[model samples]
Target chain A: MSVLEGINSKALKTGDLPPPSPSPNTFRIYSMRFCPAAQRALIYASVKKIPSEVININLQQKPDWYFTKNYKGQVPTLEHAEGKKLVIESAVIPEYLDDIFPETKILPSDPYEKVQQKLLLERLSDQLTPAFGRVFRAIKNPEELKEKFESILKAFEEAESLLEGAFYSGTSSPGFVDYLIYPSFQRVYWLTFLLEIFPLPSDNFPGPGYPKLSQWFKAITAIPEVAAASQSTENGVGSCKEYMKGLPYFDYGL
Target chain B: MSVLEGINSKALKTGDLPPPSPSPNTFRIYSMRFCPAAQRALIYASVKKIPSEVININLQQKPDWYFTKNYKGQVPTLEHAEGKKLVIESAVIPEYLDDIFPETKILPSDPYEKVQQKLLLERLSDQLTPAFGRVFRAIKNPEELKEKFESILKAFEEAESLLEGAFYSGTSSPGFVDYLIYPSFQRVYWLTFLLEIFPLPSDNFPGPGYPKLSQWFKAITAIPEVAAASQSTENGVGSCKEYMKGLPYFDYGL
Candidate 1:
């Protein structure tokens, strides 16, 4: 499959792969195309209009230096000012970006509301993301798939209850919570599409049960910055299919 | 077993169980005595001298209303201003407390340092805490315990390297990262003591493999606030014994 829109497809398999072309003073984000965690950072940077170079990494075949950069070897590792400082972990990176670009505030001004937004993201990452992963792993098992899907629905319902306004930020503008969740839901959209091709006993996707969550999703996706920053749904489905085949998944061919 | 000091021993099994005597306008934290996650919040509040009432819950027999408060029914759920606002998740709660009480800043002033602190906590929560849990669950299986312990050691090594100064915050006082990790380590300390009574091959705890981490741990524990907030080592071991016996753990006899 060819590289999709907004997706970086460079493949660097050897230790000798040269460091990304320097952006000098600008921040750089080490990312993988299809990684939801990495996408959160990327979307935040884009939404905040922060000038950052998104350096795509082939996680499966990372270079030796990548480990030195982030010992965990995970994506969304932000290299600040050409490696003067580096930060890892998806949750930390986005918040860091918000702090550096306070003018374009992704987090809320009110401390209480800000904490509430963070709590929602924390719940999603801790509960929903793992359940989403299980759905892919249990593709062949109807019982397991159904159970995982139900778990995802429960998370969505909780999220729906949390949403009070147009966005999770309670503003029209997409914020930290929106970026935190959108990528995972995007993957779910792709999973639903793929499930149609490869049917299961309980293959039905969890339709939007909560009106607020449904409206919030629509509002966030409608934003130009979010739309431009997201990877294609088609590519996500393809990667998931490869993952199910026990192949090297997440390899979006450059 | 009688409840230990600083531990709440009240048991409430249903919705009909009365809410604890109201603190009215003051802040309240719904917590369990031996919960490391809850301890993190309590220790943070203590370190900052945040005036909040700690409402101890018998988690094994939670009141029905507690679920309404925090759907997860987890401890360390902070009810801000007598439930005007609520925040759950150990990670989120401490950070929330830190934000509201910025006078005693647990998070760093510098953006880069702040992110690093968060990343360290993120790594500990994601990697070390689970390994620590497995060590408890795999107590009967020496090989699994050994494997889990080794994984934990790797995390410690990484953490040790992150410690350039006295504390993870690179300051004299324990901060966000310290509060985040100390409780888990306290649990580990008890686990090690219990393991001594119930020995296994490779039974030796990861005895401060890195000099910096050893020094860091010593420095943090030495702080007055930290010492005041921590549960007794004896209580932790007793709790772990009950945990291993497949009985309800965290019953720190007040």
Candidate 2:
């Protein structure tokens, strides 16, 4: 992913985030380097080998043009270079990308199986992601943390049952479900290492149960595309610790 | 939409909700008649003219089997009769149905345009829907209510800017964006009539600046499919009043 001109990829501060430029025919992704959601789009692009410009933005102090491009000013906003059409929302952008670039299909070909993958994505979004967020926000009391942990575990168990083959896509290649859940899992792994709050089961530390999900995590992280898009654990932990302190931290600036 | 055999379309109560039946060849939608989210699925089915058995379930007293089907026990769960494959989440099911039955497409043919519609849907989901929910939960203080109302209007204004034609879909017929947003707008209309907490803009009362959105709403509600799927203002208001009072109100049971 090529970094845009005039925007220092390594010096993105709160007020230093550059505005969106007129890209008439170059696909650009407006993102923050460390945001899990942004990483989702990046990982997808990496896996598909779709070359595009990636413009890292500071979420805390967004440029005026950023809000103009997207009312919510959220990251993972895809700018279609040709028409300058912008698509926001983490859930929508990835699917939109897959649809436009049929060369590498992120979604399953079988409609039923695709529906199942979408269902699994929905479960992670609704159940696990929020629990994961609560842990990262570091606002949960002990009892609340316990409840959240239980919910996260339940989500993991459900995911374990959903895995029919080596991958959630039921193929050798990772698809929509894999990309959808991997970012959050990656973040949680970092959180567990840094904070020691809720020890989520992973290949590194396989908890008593959830064998399938643990193995699946190992398989996903081992993918060359995923490995290329991933941030170093030290960098991830540093940024997360800063985030926990309510500091504005962007990995690209680190 | 055919009603399930054992489940009474009327007289559905907490304790009276039936368990999932062994239907091997009939698509089933487990829904609460008055739920806007469920209504979204129903309206999609109506527009597509897909024949499916609609099972009205008492949300407050969901059967144990329902939890087994969907862990969250949320309504608008689509059960594929053949494989017993369950698809939950309001966003996923409608799209799944459209994908399976390609006779009528809810999304646009142009990939970029579909991306735009999805973005609009995301705006509704993130901004307007939550604001509408806050009004219904009826727990916000006066200041918070005012703030939420302002945010809701902001969402409307942004939506107005997004409108390129008579519909958000940029065509004569209502599409994914239309179906996604209309249910929340319909519910807000009812809330305004019943609670009078936040008088949201509609075609009849067009609030000051959102001319496009107001006109779009008028067009959408005028469609035969939407009209058929909608509840009357009297019925909607009555249901809202009952909901506010903690009473069980299902249109099927009424």
Candidate maximizing lDDT: 1
Q: In model 2, what lDDT does residue B176 have?
A: 94
Give me the runs in candidate 1 sitting further than 4 Å from their true place: A1-9, A140-148, A157-162, A197-212, A242-254, B1-16, B20-25, B140-148, B152-155, B197-210, B245-251
Residue-wise C-alpha lDDT for candidate 2, range A85-199, written one tens digit per residue: 8887777777787788887878876777888877778767676688777665543366566666666667667767877887787788678989878988787677667645665
Question: Compared with the true structure, what per-residue lDDT tens digits does model 1 show for residues B1-254?
Answer: 11113345454455546555445666777787788888888788777777667777778778878887788898888886656788888878877776877887778878888777877788767767886787888888876777777766776667667777777776776678877798876676676677753332222333435667666666767777777667677777887788778787655465
Residues B218-238 of candidate 2: C-alpha lDDT, one tens digit per residue: 777877777666677777788
Query: Please, what are the lDDT tens digits per residue for candidate 1 over residues A1-254?
Result: 21122346464555656565445667777788788898888788777776666667777778778887788888878886757788888877877777877887778867898888887787776766886788878888877777778766776667667777877766766778888888887776677677753221222233435667666666766777777677666677777788778787656544
Residue A164 in model 2: lDDT: 80
The TM-score values for the models, in the order shown, are: 0.86, 0.86
